[model samples]
Target: MNTKRLGTFVAAILVLDAMAHLYWLVRPASDPRALSMAVLNMDVPFTPRVLLPLILLLTTAAIAIVAVSRGRGGWPAKAVVFALGAGLLVRGALGLVWSSGLGTDTGTPFYRLNLLLYTPVCLIAAGSVGLVLARTRRTGARV
Candidate 1:
């Protein structure tokens, strides 16, 4: 895809992630334990203290993506986008490994969801961002 389209795709993914965190923050699951296990593969509380920072981070990522895509922000914006892509790539790779029962239990809901949803989304978003970076480099555009 073109750089613009790729950036838009990545930004959408980030926005959706932010929305999901917002949902968790506003309407916590009936069973926080189950929800946490299913989502994070851990027992950590899904409180606003946790979700709020995630929401902010995801929102910032989306904004940075939009700015970079529009060629509005300079290298600093591009750097943020690059960092976001790298972080997603690492998370996806780790998810793939963990979901395969290497680091996490295969029977857990998180394993299934990570394998089916989270991992793929992260990988796709990372790839889209990578494509945008490449296109910008090739075209000599200030993305």
Candidate 2:
């Protein structure tokens, strides 16, 4: 995909991920069912106390990178795509371990959801970058 589309896609994933986490952060403690469920399902550390601002900062950075890279074509886009994908892949593996028994708890639903979501997103993003890089390399070889 082109840089613009790639950046937009990356940004979308970042925004969605951030929003999902933020939703969990803002949920009230009074709702016993939800609070209990949250305690059981989510493993995130911040709660509203720390999570909201951090997510916003991360999403903003992703969006800003997209906005700035609109005109550029080449390594920047590829790098970001690869970085995002690699980050996810590594984290997902770690999550599997954490959820399986390595950690104190299996983690929250919110954490699990992000972990699951990142699997495919990272695959697509990283695969796209790898494919592009391979094609470019082959074409360069021909020339």
Candidate 3:
């Protein structure tokens, strides 16, 4: 894929990640359900200290992947994208598993949302990055 298309896809992935983080951050921390879930050790709540820095790291990585992938030599760019992509995929899968077995009850809605729905979104973003990397490699772009 060309730089423009690659950039667009990566940008979209970043936007999706931001939106998910926003939802998690804005949700009421002290909600009775959340606390109830916490009692069961199922729903660990989000703190700004954790979420904000995570967001920053992910954002920086996204930008770096775009820049390095587009700049001179290709391997470095591909490596960055692959590393981040695979990491996200693993994180998302683990998050899903955590969501499934967590909280007061097996049927908690948060579990369904986080594990079932959102996990795949992260995986798809990771897969997109992988696809772009494969394309770059096929084109024989040197790192």
Candidate 4:
């Protein structure tokens, strides 16, 4: 895809992720433990304290990506988008390993979701970001 489309795709993903976190924050699951396990693959509480900051971060990332998509922001915005992509790439790679039952427990909700959803989304977002960067570079536009 072109730079604009790719950036929009990444931004949409970030926004959706932020909204998901917001949903968890506002209406926590009846079974917090199960929710946590399904989402994080761990028992850590998905408290407001955790979800709030994460929500903010994801929102900020979406904004940065949008700016990059429009070719409006300069280096700083580009840097944020780059960092976001790199982080997602790392997370996706690790998720793949964990889903294989190497680092994480097998037959768990987290493992299944990571394999079916989270890992693939992250990888796709990361690749789309890379394409945006590349397209912008070729067009002599600031990302």
Candidate 5:
């Protein structure tokens, strides 16, 4: 598969997500339903609310650089992709515990929205990146 395309896809999603987070961070009231995409129904410190998405944005940027660069190889690429996948997995899917019929909802739309929508996207992006990285390693292509 084309790792560059996958990287682009991941970058696009992460950029959008980062923008959304940044918006919410700067204007915390703009988020409809008043629930966080990263944190569930609980109150979060300003640090995570601002930094998580910013850090994720940087991670995606790095992934895009590695994927698009011709020098893509070695542990650097692997480490970046690994970190991206792990971060997305944690931020996206894990929130299902509070939203997915676990019966602990704070009754915010974000829970359902996250569980049904963005989290899946995150998982897909992460999986695609991992698949591309693995393919690159297997075929010895400069993914």
Candidate 6:
């Protein structure tokens, strides 16, 4: 798809993600991490439990606009796109590390959720930003 639509898709995903986190923020008792902690001994803090998702929503909203604006004409657009891609990629890649290779068991549903759900979403987001970044490179080609 074109840059605007791709950005829209990413924004929609971010909105959905934020909504999920919103559910947790509203009903902390029902937060999924509670199960992860109870079953797998992982502890997520308030930063990630609430703030990060809100930040992600805001950032994605900004980046979505940037990604569709003017086809990467300036440093601001490039920076936003790069930051967005990097954040998503790190979320997916680092999540793999975070959930694996400790005394931690990889077979639990917590890890499974990251594997099956979170990581894929992140990678897809990164790919969307990456596409926008790719167009920036091509359009920036010197004569």
**Residues 9-117, model 4: lDDT tens digits:** 8888988989998998888889999998888877888899899999998988888888887787888888998999899999999988987789777788888889999
Q: Which stretches of candidate 5 lie over 4 Å from their true place?
A: 25-33, 37-39, 45-49, 52-74, 91-99
* Per-residue lDDT over 7-114 for candidate 5, one digit per residue giving the tens place of the 0 to 100 score: 777777766767766766666554434454334555555456556767576656555535643346456666766777788777656655645656445455666676
Q: Positional deviation of 112 in candidate 4, in angstroms?
A: 0.9
lDDT of 5 at 74: 56
Decreasing TM-score order of the candidates: 1, 4, 5, 6, 3, 2
TM, every model:
0.94, 0.52, 0.63, 0.94, 0.70, 0.68
Provide the lDDT at 133 for model 4: 72
What digit string (tens of lDDT, one per residue) describes model 1 on residues 24-117? 8999889999998888888999889999999998888888887777665788888889999999999999988987689888888899999999
- For model 3, the stretches where C-alpha displacement exceeds 4 angstroms are 1-7, 19-45, 68-79, 95-105
- Writing each residue's lDDT as its tens digit, candidate 2 over 55-84 gives 866576465436433533355544554565
Report the C-alpha displacement of residue 17, candidate 2, in angstroms: 1.2
lDDT of each: 0.86, 0.55, 0.63, 0.86, 0.63, 0.65
* Better candidate by TM-score, 2 or 4: 4
Question: Residue 11 deviation, candidate 6, in Å?
Answer: 1.0
User: Tens digits of per-residue lDDT for model 3 on 98-143?
Assistant: 6658432456665666665657777776776766666656766554
Lowest summed lDDT across 10 adjacent residues in model 6 is found at 64-73
Question: After best superposition, candidate 2 residue 39: deviation in angstroms?
Answer: 11
